[model samples]
Target: MVDWAAYTLVFVAGLITALATGIGALPFFFVPDISEKFNVGLWGVASGIMMAASIFGLIPEGLNAGPWTTVAVGLVAGGLLVLVANDLLMDADIDSRTYEEADFKKLVLILGVLTVHSFPEGIAIGVSFAELNLGSGIPLLGFTVPALAIAMTIAISIHNIPEGVAISIPLRTMGVAEWKMVWWSIFSSLPQPLGAVIAFGFVQLAEPLLPAGFGFAAGAMIYLVLSEFIPDALEAGEELDGKGYRELVAGFAAGGGAMVLLLVVV
Candidate 1:
């Protein structure tokens, strides 16, 4: 028997994290020009929060589960899933020119790509809720919530800011209304709640697999930070400043250090 209430709460948490990305789009509403420096900084913050959450929250939870082999396998599987999705999307010849210029088919393609991009984030949120009243000791909404749930929620929300900005930049150029940008950004992340519910259900059904769930989320996120987010930040910064590499390195170090400190303290 599944605990419906716990699943609902986890879904809500994931939804809230997804919605927080909308906040990043809000800046475009007032500020016509968003500085490149600001974008880099936002990425830095996102990276920091994600790393902190993965290390302090997800990995630790995974360790609580049985053998290391389970976690290792889950991590590799999660990363491979993202890679496969990326390959499929990249192979498709979807135009990335303009949102308005894109036909319905192109829009669908874009959404598909976005889904691959966002799924792991949703999974992280979902897996974090594994301990929902099952054992862990944090309390929320009349149930004993896992601390990892709270941490993942906060981490994902912070990480989404840069993503929202990335989405808004294109929409802005396409002359999409600011509010519409916010809506679309939120729309891009809509899968999170569904992911959360599914993951929570899985954990509830297979309690023993909870640790693997944690490792899956953590591995996916850490891989993203290393492979995609950091590289994107550096490239973006390079285009803006001749010494972009320096800035990228500084930002990465600072972000990673901050996350480490947070983990240590919290």
Candidate 2:
């Protein structure tokens, strides 16, 4: 009874997002360094895409599938999970710098941190595809892909590019090779496929929970955009006169517009 084929498609979608992180490191092969302003803009762009996807894509989908109350509960639960994970890992924080001298235990700790950060994104992709083979959707390559699924996959892929850049910066400064930088960036998000498959399976089995799944993914992403993404952009943009708010806003508009355009086309 298991739709292994559909699951395979979902995993592939998640894998695509994870691989997208590598794109960030490709520029390093040609340039000595990326501008801080550009990095800030990337973060802003990521935040904008995530926020738009959550608010316009996920939340509405959740409402359409089930009651608003259930969706609210899911939102809270999703936000809480992120908050608690951060709190738990607050002291366990390790960075690219930590790896050079890290032991096996330390390496495991680093991976755990990366997994926590990237897992929700995978979940969002999975939740978006909950109706993958169950209902009417865009047909492609013999699969009924939800429009939201395509949108989330694209959104998450774009979002991960900045994350890849962030991961690569420290490695680049550490004299790591460009190819290794790309590899490490991809590794940071490697847990995505697992998260995607698990979430997709859960929603497909428990149909009633579909809406909550949508809300959970949306809530976690939106919270991350606010609490982490925007602040990061601001921090990186400090040298920009009058702050990098302008660049940040511009990036946001562009990212959001891209999502809107994709949705319209799909």
Write model 2 residue lDDT over 23-57, tens digit each, in one string. Answer: 97898899776587776666666667667767877
- Give the number of the best model, judged by TM-score: 2
Q: List the residue pairs that clash in candidate 2.
A: none
Assess each prediction's global lDDT (C-alpha) against the native. 0.67, 0.73
Question: Model 1, 50: alpha-carbon shift in Å?
Answer: 3.3
Give lDDT for model 2: 0.73
True lDDT of residue 2, candidate 1: 64
Clashing pairs in 1: none
Give the TM-scores of the predictions, in the order they appear.
0.61, 0.64
